[model samples]
Target: MSLAQPAPTPSRWLRAALPAMFILLGVIYATWASRLPAIRDLRVLDAATLGTILLGGGLGAVLSFPLAAWLLAHYGARRAALYAGLGLLFGLPLLGVLPNWWLLFAGVFVLGAASSCFDVAINAIGAEQEREAGRSIMSMLHAWFCVGTFSGALVGSAAAGLGLSPLWHFLLVAFVLLLMLICAYRILPCDAPDPDAGKKHFALPHGALIWLGLIAFLGAISEGSLTDWISLYLTDHLHASEAGAPLGYAAFAGAMLVARLVGDRLKDRFGARRLVAGSSLLAAVGLGVAIAAPSFGVAVIGFVLTGLGVAAVFPCLFSAAGREGPTALAGVATLGYSGSLMGPPLMGYAIHGYGYVFGMALLAVVSVFVAVAAMRARLLV
Candidate 1:
């Protein structure tokens, strides 16, 4: 099980296909966020109610992780991934068409559950692939997610510009995702988890894993806060034009994508602990710079810095989770995902009560906590 062992290299097509699937997932998921206004108008739900309903998706995702692990163990990673992708194809289009808040909520919940299951299974498979390849590949895998988000945002903007309905936009994207999933089906591994892995049950997170979960939670909070509110912050606090406001998030995402693309080399040279620690500190500095800047241009620089700082943390955390034990990796990943789930709503509440600048400042403080925790965990490779 040592990662040092020489293993067969994956084909170029497989490497390319894997990231493409992740990108497709990101594009499909992000389409909903970009069209939030349309969905709200269609469903006639207020902000508060909408937030509450969105929590159902998080709940469903959390609940599904254990089952996902069991399925991966029994049915194998390929089947689990295929089922999850099919679920996305089935569930994503409903968001565009659902006319009622209740139906939209239910659809989102199922989508979340299926997506979470897919996430764990795919990560496990990807980690295995990386181990076999004898190189660090996780960061690039996540980079594709950022790439997908970027693509989705661009598509959303195009649709908005054209005055296209959300349903039509999503339908097109869903068809594309369906086709991509079909194409990637063959390269996905059918390997099952080891049989003697023991009884699987949902249990509360404990030990170093709990600490790792907290680190992930704090890191996610920083990331989620920026992604969810950076645009609003630019508009409300910096007085940037609506068109310019999204630049904050765009800069962040672009920087993150760049960092992730090169992160494996960085990790190989510096180790995960150093990288995580440096990233947290850089993120904190970025937040501070953005908050204190006098102009939107400077704030954009800050956003880019924050993105660079945050880019590699997720892959490092996921790799650590996998190394903790194959049997426990799903539960750990679930905990991490749970942290990510909490970040958006909490940041929303913070923004509502304290204003966007203060909320981001709070996130900067949390980023410091992530640095300290990463140092304490000492889980770097």
Candidate 2:
């Protein structure tokens, strides 16, 4: 093959291995997220402190953008993914075994950094595959991520109910993820270094990308806040049982999984802008309902709606970014992921001062911003 020819996409292995990797990614994140209440109880941390610790993870994610770019440039997507994945598998157990919340903050920071880096690598490969096949598949791949989180949340609920220690639970999940990672390492497409990666290490979103980033920013705040706080809200505010607390996130992830499974079709039918605008509005409504819920069951129904509402936002936005090329995609993704991962810790302070009600309400308001931003986004199609 001529050097001018782009890398050949993988065979059927891409279909099988890539989605499994996304699922594993989701599982790893949800394993820790679903168990936040237990960790809080173990560390005897208040909301403020827990939020501070969670901030470390968000900081790590934001800071990893350059590192991710550097790695993808030097090593290629597969090894970048492998390295980050190993970092996560190694770091997660530390969250469970840490001596205190202070130490836990350090571990979570590393976790976030690795998680975001892995995400960038995986999406980079997925975009390449989609471009090569001349089709749409980003949504489907992200659907698998939703599947992983849903499954992880359910398993976490069971573990918490069984009175399993966080250390043991993390270890078991990490082992399973390791097996999945091994398989993925062998089958995933071998995209070479991004040709322009060196020059674009610190690229920032601009023009249309800024609008797309805005949508991602608000969408992520809603998504991340719920992932990090919804269960705790169930437990502390609604007085849910240990087993039942995680059900809130399970509902969210499950609903998102179902929606994302069909997200490509929906995006094709309605168009990206319409789908995002409508979905953001739906998320706002659903989150409002959840916040106002009088009982745990009622709150779960709201979370389900919220899940359905936000499901299409990321996939639609990311796919749009892909059309703009990898550099733009990376820039928008960095901005978005930073918000999604980092915004939650910031919300902790608000929740600490005013309460969970305020925190949830703030997210509901932000969902409106997502809708408005999507409506205005010129790059969405």
Off by over 4 Å in 1: 1-10, 37-47, 100-102, 201-204, 231-247, 293-296
Which candidate number would show the highest TM-score if scored against the true structure? 2
Candidate 1 per-residue lDDT, tens place, 206-242, comes to 7777766777768876775566466657766888654
- Per-candidate count of clashing residue pairs (backbone under 3 Å): 0, 0
TM-score of each: 0.87, 0.95
- The global Cα lDDT (0 to 1) of model 2 is 0.86
Residue 227 displacement (Å), model 2: 0.5
lDDT of each: 0.74, 0.86
Worst 10 residues of 2 by lDDT: 1-10
Model 2: per-residue Cα lDDT over 18-136, one tens digit each: 89889988998689888999999988999999989998888898899888878887777788888999999999988998978878889989999999889888888888777887867
| RMSD values, in order shown | 4.8, 3.2
